[model samples]
Target: MSVARTLFRLTLLAGALSPGLAHAAGLDGSQLSLLWALPFAGLLLSIALFPIVAPEVWHHHFGKISLGWALAFLLPCALWLDPATAGGVVVHAMVDEYLPFIVLLFALYTISGGILITGNLHGSPVLNTGLLALGAACASLMGTTGAAMLLIRPLLRANDNRRHNVHVVVFFIFLVGNIGGGLTPIGDPPLFLGFLKGVSFAWTFSNMLLPVLTACLILLVVFYLLDSHYYRKEGVLPRDPTPDNARLGIQGVFNFALLAGVVGAVLMSGMWQPGLDLNVLGVKVGIQNLLRDGILLTLAGASLALTPTTLRDANEFNWGPIAEVGKLFAAIFITMAPAIAILRAGPQGDLAALVALVSSADGSPINPMYFWLTGSLSSFLDNAPTYLVFFNLASGDATQMMTEYSATLLAISAGAVFMGANSYIGNAPNFMIKAIAEQRGVPMPGFFGYMGWAWVFLFPLFVLLTLVFFR
Candidate 1:
């Protein structure tokens, strides 16, 4: 093993043992400078080493490079820090506090439009837009992953006849799989962390509506125009509305019931807090007792019992999505812990100066703008940690000196979560969608290529959102 990889793994091992100890120790200017330099050096080293790691790992897992860069700098920080701080950060991240919301959102997503119980409205010009709208709405309910799996195959089939069809897949990823998930805690993981941190769950819904709607509306228009251009170029004649296939009938009302049961169990799990006191069996138990011994066991049972076979037909159920999401996000969940710790140490002078420039003297300008830009970057990084870093800075309690800042800290939180879907890597589902698409034999663009599409399509929508809401 090279020196860099050895150091990298050791850092992760230390972080797993103890988290965030380095930052709390108060590194001096020179030490902080060295810390700052590590990410860049690590990024370069990882890129250089990526090709040599393993042939199949490179071919099958190369998309993980974006995540690799995030952990490189983080692991080193953890290794060098105090054990207490590092342990706390690592434990807090690992506890899966957001798993209940993840389960609920996924349940709703798969059950709603994802189950495809109603079937696609045949021959409608609005088919694509309607699906996108449904997708966006579902995202806030089911999460991007759930909604993406439920709809992607049908959407791809809907456009299967078109010869020049790359844009449809690209836009599907941009909207349904990613940006749509930004509106609610259920929509994405990063926002769920915000909710757990004390941001009201309902506040995100109202705050992100305008931006979500604007992006959906614009993307719908662009999708129409692009789909039309491709439709024309291929000279693909439109088919008259086909007869409805009632054979693929709704056999899953019970599955829906089971799905709801699973959701309820998850929500109930959230109410119990670790280390709080409770009395049971003539013995006093902490909240952790209920959560670990009682709630988790119940959750496992509900999930197992709620497993419905109707999904086999209703959504053309396959394990591919489950496998894909599991593999990519598992890597993200494990590797990105260190990255979150380093950012938690707070910004350095250059970063602080950059943030000041981004935030206006009016305070309002910088907050929303930072919300969008940070959100855009968050898509490529593991968005949860990226969201935390920006959330800390934007809500850093330093707003006393600024002017014209009327929005609450919650709105900043909303903006970061809502806008995280601007690229493939912005959130976990985005990459999962890409991976599943490729696995199913759909040719897709490389990382930079996908971003090119986002730059053209999403950037304008973001600008419009800023004009309408943030301004």
Candidate 2:
């Protein structure tokens, strides 16, 4: 899940005592120019292009590159905006968003790494499809991150002997990392935010069923067919790496309890409010949130200490991807703040013309535009905040949104959950899967190259969705 709902509603009392301080601390997007987004765009372009252009340089200096882009935004904020605001933004990004996000992923990655699914299951078309299906089904229950982390290693192991198995990983990201999260509030950050804002727990599952099923069915079918073709073309696979023919079973079962702990932490943070906010600088950090993060870190540390190192070694557990994701996304979250603020500014922002497209002159919501716009932004920005923006933009009243405007809500939900498959940065797990697949010697596509896969496979379905559902 993303930051709890209370994080953004920083205690205004601290700001009221100092007017200039408050204005600087809370970026007024209506006053911001579109030029503020340059650093965000630049960082994204670097993430996309650098690996293809200079793999060695990217591998060595990506952290520095990301930091530079972050500075590009922060330096201006300090010199031009105000020092207090700049510092506040940095703290906000680190504490409010980045740390919790990374900690949850860290916990899942570590705990799931300890879970060894022992056995030599051949990566036949049918078997791989079944794995994808299983992972997807588990996603709505344990979140996209949990399901992906738990199943990815086994999937990779099963397909280790296959030459043309890159597509399998691609489809896995499509189904498990993105589309599978559509059915429940616990499944994705956006829906969880909806739950925080008073949307019923059953709302997403009930309303999103058809769209989720539609996506799963289409992607699963295409994947099976494509995987079958690859299987035939690459007949006589390389000798199985782990053909030890031992009975299939799960090892390091205690880690599952730790995973349950991770899920519980996220749920408690959102659902339990003690009403006590810790004043960190001018920002009001919720105590429950702090406790949730502590629990997450403790669980992660416990996984490292309690789970045998041999188990991790067998699973090829390494922190490279998580560390890299942290560095890159820290910059992403900071740089994109101005853009998110602009979007949150609604009709008054510099992007007012863009926001206007979501509604007509009479202010009725445009369903197709809602889906496409939300999906388009969610493809690049964090889907959680993007969903919140559209949620508030639509009505912000859960009862009204869940009833008279249910169609609009569904569009927003589908867009935020479904189109995350459009790009790796669209959701956290997409890039993780890509990195892990590459580390395991699968030739995963470059950023744009992966988008090409999305374009070829997913665009038609989106249009079809619009026609049948949003229209």
Best by TM-score: 2
Residues 277-377 of candidate 2 have per-residue lDDT tens digits of: 87664557899989998999899899899989898898898998887787788889889999999999988998888889999879899999999999999
Tens digit of per-residue lDDT, candidate 1, span 1-471: 432243335345544452333233333332244354554445434433543465466555534553454455445645775544433333333333223323443443344332444443432336766777777777666667667766776666555445555676787777777768767766776666666555555666776676677777788888887777666676654652323563334544454554444434434434445556643222234564345334434543444355465554544555455444443343344444443444445444434554554455666446565666566546555666676666666654323212223253433554555455555546656656675566556777666567688788877776776677765
Off by over 4 Å in 1: 1-93, 96-125, 237-248, 261-321, 330-339, 347-350, 358-365, 396-411
Q: Whole-model lDDT for model 1 versus the true structure? A: 0.54
RMSD of 2: 4.2
Model 2 residue 116 distance off true place after TM-score fit, in angstroms: 0.7
Q: Count the backbone clashes (under 3 Å) in each candidate.
A: 16, 0
TM-scores, one per candidate:
0.70, 0.94
